[model samples]
Target: MNRRETRDAVVHFGPDADWVREAAAESSAVAAADGVASYDEPEADAGAADAAGARLAVCELSPDAGVEALAAVRDALPTVPVLAVVADADAVDDALAAGAADVLVRRDGVDDTALLARRMEGVAATPAESRLGAESTAQLLDAIDDSFYALDADGAIRRWNDSFSRLTGYEDEELAGMDALELFAGADRERIAGAIETVVETGSATAKAELVARDGETTPVEFTGALVTDADGSPSGIVGIGRSLTERREREARLARLRQAVETIVDRAPLTLFEVEADGTVSTVRGETLPERLGRRVSEGDAAEGVFADQPEMRRHVAAALDGEPAHGLVEVGDSTLEAWLQPALDETGRVTRAVGLALDVTEREERAVMLDQIQASAGEVIWISTPGKESMDFVSDAYEDVWGRAPETLRSDPMSFVEAIHPDDRERVEAALTEQREDPDAYEETYRVVRPDGEVRWVHDQSSGVYEDGELTRIVGIATDITVRRRRERELRLKNRAVETAPVGVAIHETAESAGPITYVNEAFASVTGYDGDAVAGEGLSALAGDDTDSDRLHAVASAVKTGDRGSATLVLYRADGTPFWGRVDVAPVVDGDGEATHAVSFVQDVTESKEHEQEIERHLTEFGEVLAEDLGVPLREARDRLDAATDDDPDADLRRAEESVERAVSLVEDLATVHSFSVEPRRLSESMRGSSPAPAGRDE
Candidate 1:
């Protein structure tokens, strides 16, 4: 037959036994090739076998009888490529092992016998070159890194590469005739077997399994299997390739562990942590148990579009972060406040893919800050904090209005404004003190002046401490107290002391000791009288000025009396520094204490030297005057007495008459002189004695 006619001469083997009817229609124009006569059943099988050396047989096995029937068919026609037709694809593997060259799984609306005959013709026409070419292809596959295997229809291994042996830890001798199911680990055996059956039935399957090696080590593997078709275009067996997934699975497990560890840390932290996706969908909320509002999932629409949302500022910040800008702010969440920080998630191209949020609960800190502000507002002193520049104040307390006569907000704008309010005279001193305090933080005190709005000046005492960050001065925080009243009181006391220092008179002060002794404090007058400077006897005992002849007992008694609030006077001999003596009357009085105790003594002394001399002169004058008066009387009376003696003895009469005039005159003159002398002498003597005796011993009533 010609090439084209020969294609038509090959009868597609589907019509039951109507060969004559087909041949009569074709005529002899295309002669049919002499081949085989076919029969449908066992009764005509002998004739069909006699006509052609080989008999075409079609067999269908029940799901249970499939394997046994295939085996019997293989013994009957060992050389024929039996095309076994099966209802299910699962029987294809057993059929191929029983010497069936190909298999066809029945599908709806398909002529199986005709389809098989066409496929056979196409196979027969192909040269042996294709088979040899397939051998070379298998060799190339063996060179790859992956394990490859082909199982026969009997579920037995047909061919495999060296990689299979290496991967399974099996030698060629042990694996050549073994069942492929033996390579599966116990956990994967049933799964692998089921996959093989699926591939046989469906012509393709895929499975991942843990496979066991000859040494009992397990490795994760992925298997991709396909049915190997025969000449009749029917499934004959399964060919599978395995790839070791050990490294891939290990990577996945490590990633899982890392994620778990991160979650654990975030959950245990006191601060909140969260993640936002590209669309602003929040996920992965973790922290100390927080309010439900914080834990709720937030979407872009919820943040950007919703009204009555409390965290509008936070939402704006997060939106900015998604746009590749970082933002941080304070916001109030459900039941707590937080300081929220938003960062951008970057992709490989350095573009922001999403935003991640990290929130810290700062509720307690905010509350404390508010309370501190209230306390500062109520303080009586001005409180402030300054930066290292010393040129500005960041925070100033409200009490600045009372202490510095300026609003706290004014100082906050310009810290130097407070400095300008200082009194010009005190400005330099205040600056020096502040500079010194800054240099040595331990020197924390400063005094300065502040001029009020009413033009009154006030003294301010500032106590401060340096705040250091990284060994650099960051700020100075301190308080300023108004000390103007205290300073005024101090000035008044100084003026009063000056008045007491210059007082007149020899006023000496004695300090009473705990042991009832006395120490002297002499003023300038006391120093002049004692011929010693005030410093010379400052701490000396009061008795140090007395001489050995001085009446010590009387002096002690006077001191004791004076200490008990009784005034005393004494005519005592005082010893000078040169060991000379002087008699003077001294008066002592108590310096009473607050509790009415005589804790000190004060003595006022005056010199009586001139007065004592005047008294002595007066006494001598009186004595001379008395003597002259007696003598004059005696002389005058002698004349009168001689005349009066003759009259009183004879002069009582004649001397009374002639001497009566002389005698009377003599008596009158004598009486006048006597009276004058007596008056002068008596007054002078009494005055001198009284001046000397006015002082008595201590404790005496005078």
Candidate 2:
């Protein structure tokens, strides 16, 4: 047996039991070899176990003495490890049932003393392990929130608590009997091993290192270890408590980010920081040269009182802060406005210790607000603001009363009443816009008519947008503009357009350009006169109307005048849709904008074909009349000359008189021919009369 001496072990036996002394002496020799100084007590009774410095008890029971002696020893030294030495094998069961750590039998082939010593050494290890295996140790380990593990001297994991499994993701089956150092990596493994060694060598040690989990992820952990000892005060193993640092590190990082943000704000903003003591005194004052205000009570007479004079409720805020509530308010100090926020400082026990206050200069903000109010008053449009989805107006400028002709107070009291005032035809559209604004809260724009209390209808162009806080719609601000004049002009234009469309004269409007402008629109009359549809000529140049007999020069003149934004006329024969030609007059004028730029050209076309035919007839009639007159005068002259030649010898007065008569007769006939009723007589009779022959009478001429 490999053994060394340890503490003395108590042996309880009868006076006749001398073999125990021999066994004790041999066991001491074995224990001493194992580095334990063991002393054997042979005559010690069960009651004297503590006096003997007993680490374990060896009970001797004779076969006839029964197991009663072993039971008695067990009852006396219940905590001490016991080995029952029995000569009869049958008594082994009884000795074990009496709470013996083991049973040693004295047999013939076995060296009884050596066998008893070996069994005693086995029992020596039992007392300490038995105490640890008690329910209380497990309860104590499991009660802790942090992880715990026990490792043997060989660095093998022996026991682990529930938290160990949760933290490292290693169940009992996976971690049992594995090397505990395998849970770490790189220098962390070496460091943790060294820490465990230090704990074993000394009493305890603490270390911080990273530990690996099942998925090969490492977590920083704080480890505290202490050496575990047996009842004999010999080092056994290490029991360590390990706490994960993940949440702690995350919390620290979050706090660092918040501090950085606050620092950035403080650096950029004009602010004063003050610390208020629990007794309502300002202990520290920073920023804005307020050093003299420190250690002063925040009351009526203090320097801070002037700053908070406008905010009388500040006293209640301070009281609330001291009672563990946060507060904030705005106040005016001198000519400057300041916004103040106060937070309670809490101690470990959650009691309010003090208050930290930050005050920011808001003078610029106040000035801007005042400037906005002035802008609203000076603006011509109606300026209004309201809470989103609420039927009440928060603010409306003076223009509201002028535009809607209703008192602002009434609209403010019932905002929906404004919707009721909307023209019935436009009310549904306006309500729909309001609903859409409430749902999406984006910029809203709509033009609708409103009916005033005076029964005058006015058109309003409303444009609005939502105010948001944290991505939620909070309020709506908008402007309403009167577009009534523009709408009235539009109506007048529509009526004018209708009149032009149905006019008697053919009207065609053309686009104005540097060259011949394109025809854009043609009235129904123009279509009827041309036999060509509007679509055929629209976008076509004015030359599209010219055909075979069209007077190109006159058409060019008209087109040039229209393109140059002037009025011009052209009388030319234009071809009809069926290839027939007729005389037409085209009058073109330019349409110009306020900038005097010609945007369009309008032309009026008149068909003067009948008048032109009548003029041709008149010219023909005049030509015929001249031919008739010439013939009548020529015959008279001929006859008169013949009479003069034949009667040369006769009286000259007589021949002259004859010529005079012919001349007078020709004059009379010309006069009668010139009469309006001359065309009613026969053309031959007129010819005969002009021949200087008497009328043959109507029947004879026929």
Candidate 3:
């Protein structure tokens, strides 16, 4: 080849003057030594290479030269091949990514001068395509949604489609001087450069990289690139396609979140998720269950056999689910019961792949339901609940039939029927109490009579309390107890009280005590006889009618009888309500309780004032008569008897005379007694001296 024909023209864009000079000198020395030509165009304009008829473009990219300057040279001559020289070996990937046909990293005193000359010779010998062919290819690249770009040997952006501009939100003018490495976030630029380097070395490469958007937001992009070669089979640049993965990544993240949520629910819930194969074999199980790990088929497990024994229907349901039908049923194993639901799992072809099942334990709930049934059947009291203010009862126990003479179902259907059973006399009062309880949501209690269909009247004590929710009455729950026997005994007690109040003799009852034994009851006769009203003396001591002059011994005797639960009587001097004294014959008896202790005392009192006065008068008369006999009649008789005794001893005739005189004296004594009798019979008619004085001789003191 001729020297001019073998020599190739080169354009360099490095702003580092010293590096440019050195690179050019090295490249020229190698070209001359290798029998290739070199024409270095340092600090060249965009069109300098076309005017100089350059064979290859050489961009010397110093650390400061960056991607933009080199890209400007490459864009100026799209048909020519370009080579890049860089100072740092680490910048090789960036140089290759920017569309470098070949890169040289300058090491101190270590030159790849011969390699550079050969690469330039190969690029210069390659034929360039016509402008029309280039224009048509550019039009096709710009029409795609993905970003397409061409990078030079210097790793400078040479050409890019409109999609590239749209993806980064940059116009052609703004992108003209922009470095390709500046398109990514600071941290991702190296990674992107590495991926681009792989594409240049591997002929074709695919990787993920981060691209910075116009607003400074970074997006993930999938890059596919292939090296573009010159006619002589020398790498010239790279043609790349970048598809933004923003939407696809977002979809994947959402799927991950949804999967996490479902797993959380499965872990926390009481449900068990199971999978059964199409052949009716258990494949997997999750959540709370009989085992932590299971590998055998459902038929191989002992639990499955136990379930089949108690719930034959479960197998059928599971089978149906495996056949692409949804099914559910209950299965009991030992003491536990499970509610199992199953649905078919499908494949992409809509065929049944397996059955997915969920199981929940319902043992406690079923047992509680049975317990409630037992209580409702056996309870004696009528247990019930109802909606607040509603006429119909929500639930009622079977005891309603025995107590209210109506079925529980009847009351539940028409609660008014229970109210209608209330005795007519107490109906209004019972209803009023219920209304008040509803208004206040307090406890309800009412005792009223209920008239049965058989005309039997029975008393019932109904009690209820409101169930409140958010300060409002929601329901009423209560019990109604039969109290007929109790009410009947109360009625009898009232009749007995009426009889005691009207009793004839003075009757008083007092609590048993040593002192201040307060009177609790006083009959009408007691009030009249003691001259103290029953109301006035009730709570007063039993000795209220007994004055201070009353005998202490008699009072103690009555108190002792009451304290010891004994019976005793005393004729005591008692004062009336008017302060006048009277003799009373009182009989005291203790009222002992069931415990055999005297709790109270009852007394029967009678007035004996008139009879005692008459008896006293008779005793006074006897005493006066005795004095008359001794002093007046007895003295004369004694003198006569002495005379008679002397006569009898001296002469028989004289003894007879004495006896006659004694007889006469005895007759005189009789006469005196008669006079006393007359005074007793007519005391008021006698003089004041004769009334108190004995009827004796005048000289004698009576």
Candidate 4:
């Protein structure tokens, strides 16, 4: 390898010539030792390069503008390759935009002399036909890749180069009087026309357009022109270069797409993008959720070997990248699963030099996928995802088979097939609603009936939402639930409510029993029977209805059992709102929950006043009759007993025994009559006996 071939010395000019000299010396020593691209300095006193012959000009420019200094250097050594040096990275752009052939920041290239020298060599290596201050304008224009042309003030072409001829497919004779604007078509033509007009009026102009050729094919070109003037300062024509922007635009579009994809992942998922050198040193680390040693932030230039000490797999990925092979897969990092892709970056020599790694934190996405699997197995909801504007369904969960009674694959193939499952009565309405939602896709809610393949109708409650970015819909997610059972229960509840309202018996529904809450609801019959409207009876328990004549002990027992979620019934003297006492029969039943713990109580109340009063009257008459009989028969029974005793002889004759038997039988008849009247027992006492207790079956009985 001929690494040493003597050329010309690279001139160094700046405030820091010593710094330039030091870097130059290192490169110069290597070049001189091997006799390669070398630069000889002018005498120390001269403070300048041989202007007409210097291979390259290394000029240091002011960090602020550097415009004046750059102009002066270019003016003196017009043909030399000028590499501008700026203080910071930002100034590099300014210098380059200000007509610099190349630029290097002081901090980046100053310490790396060989790198700087190589950059200088590269600029110097440019063909003289492509460089500024070429020996002949015709030679330079012909050598340029861009189409060059000079046109008159009226847009008529005056002069042109081979590139222009090749670009437009027109010979000199054909282009002799053609208008410059005619070289373009469509919007490109109009824009170039405006740009040409601007150049004629404003002295200089730059614009991008497509130049049309004789064959109708167009090439994207960036046209930059300067107005040429005659001696009297009158615009004569315009000299311009039409640089083809095809490659540049294509490259930019590719980069934009790549950036968009990466940015989208970074926005939604936690991720880390990194670059590692061939020696296992991390050059850059950005984004999120990448595990670090002891929770430290990953820094640039950190040795990958140390940072990933415990991760042998990660080390292998980096090694693979360095070995010119790409690796990608799912990797667990702490509690998250990261989808990693490692791609190798190579130099011009095709040797793998670096590894670009992307670790997308797919933890939530993976978990959601797992949750969808579980939902498919047991959940009643069918999940679906559609493309933007719902043009197509991207994915439909397996649960679709359960809810929609159609295969998931069927729906995926034809997104609108779910409409077929909808009941005919609702299909048109659902479709209309969906059409209306397209313009405004947010929280869309709907409930309709679906007719399954088996002809079973299922009530479905479907809801969907659109995922938007920058006010543009990007995706639509939907869930449809099989709510048939819930709908059935609701219908049953409504019917039962109507029945309870219309029933003849008064009904009171207590919300809770063990906790002892007030009645939550009561049928109209209750208000009519008790003479207490719902408002008047608010917060009042059944025991509150007890009047003075009410069986207090029995009422307490019934009230106590109802509160503790026990079933009980009793007819008690209760008062209405008008201070009227009535015999009310109350029967309560406990409502227990799934666990058999009583939650509420339902009581059926009936007015038993008429029957109760009649019973009382019967008991009163029986008592009076018993008193009268006792008054009339008490002395006779005693007198008979004495006579029988007097008539009886111990072992007397048969006539004496017959008389004694007659007297005893009459006494027994009177005794039986006396006890028969005393048999009228109270209804309250009977209830107590039924409960197996005499005193209201005690123990917190209230």
Q: Which stretches of candidate 2 lie over 4 Å from their true place?
A: 1-375, 440-447, 467-470, 532-534, 539-541, 595-599, 624-702
Per-residue lDDT, model 2, residue 501, is 88
- Report the C-alpha lDDT of model 3 over 75-194, residue by residue, as the tens digit: 666665677777876555445544566677767786565555556555556556522145645665676577887777667777888989888888888877477788876667887788
**Tens digits of per-residue lDDT for model 2, 331-395:** 65657777878899999999999888887888899899999889877887998888888567898
Model 3 lDDT, residue 495, Cα: 90
lDDT of 2: 0.70
Candidate 2 versus the native: TM-score? 0.46
Clashes of each: 12, 15, 13, 10
Kindly report which residue stretches of model 1 are placed more than 4 angstroms away from their true locations once superposed.
Answer: 1-385, 391-403, 444-446, 461-472, 477-481, 513-517, 548-558, 561-573, 583-702
- Lowest summed lDDT over 10 consecutive residues: which window, candidate 3? 685-694
Ranking by lDDT: 4, 2, 3, 1
Residue 534 deviation, candidate 2, in Å? Answer: 4.1
Angstrom error of the Cα, residue 473, model 2: value is: 2.9
lDDT of 4 by residue, 299-411 (tens): 66778887676667788888888899999887666776777789999899998889999877678999998987787677668888887556689988787887677788887
Could you estimate the TM-score for every candidate? 0.40, 0.46, 0.46, 0.54
Error of 4 at 126 (Å): 26
Better of 1 and 2 by lDDT: 2
Decreasing TM-score order of the candidates: 4, 2, 3, 1
User: What 10-residue stretch in candidate 2 is worst by lDDT?
Assistant: 30-39
Q: Which portions of model 4 show Cα errors greater than 4 Å?
A: 1-159, 162-327, 332-338, 344-378, 439-443, 511-517, 613-702
- The lDDT values for all models are 0.64, 0.70, 0.69, 0.71
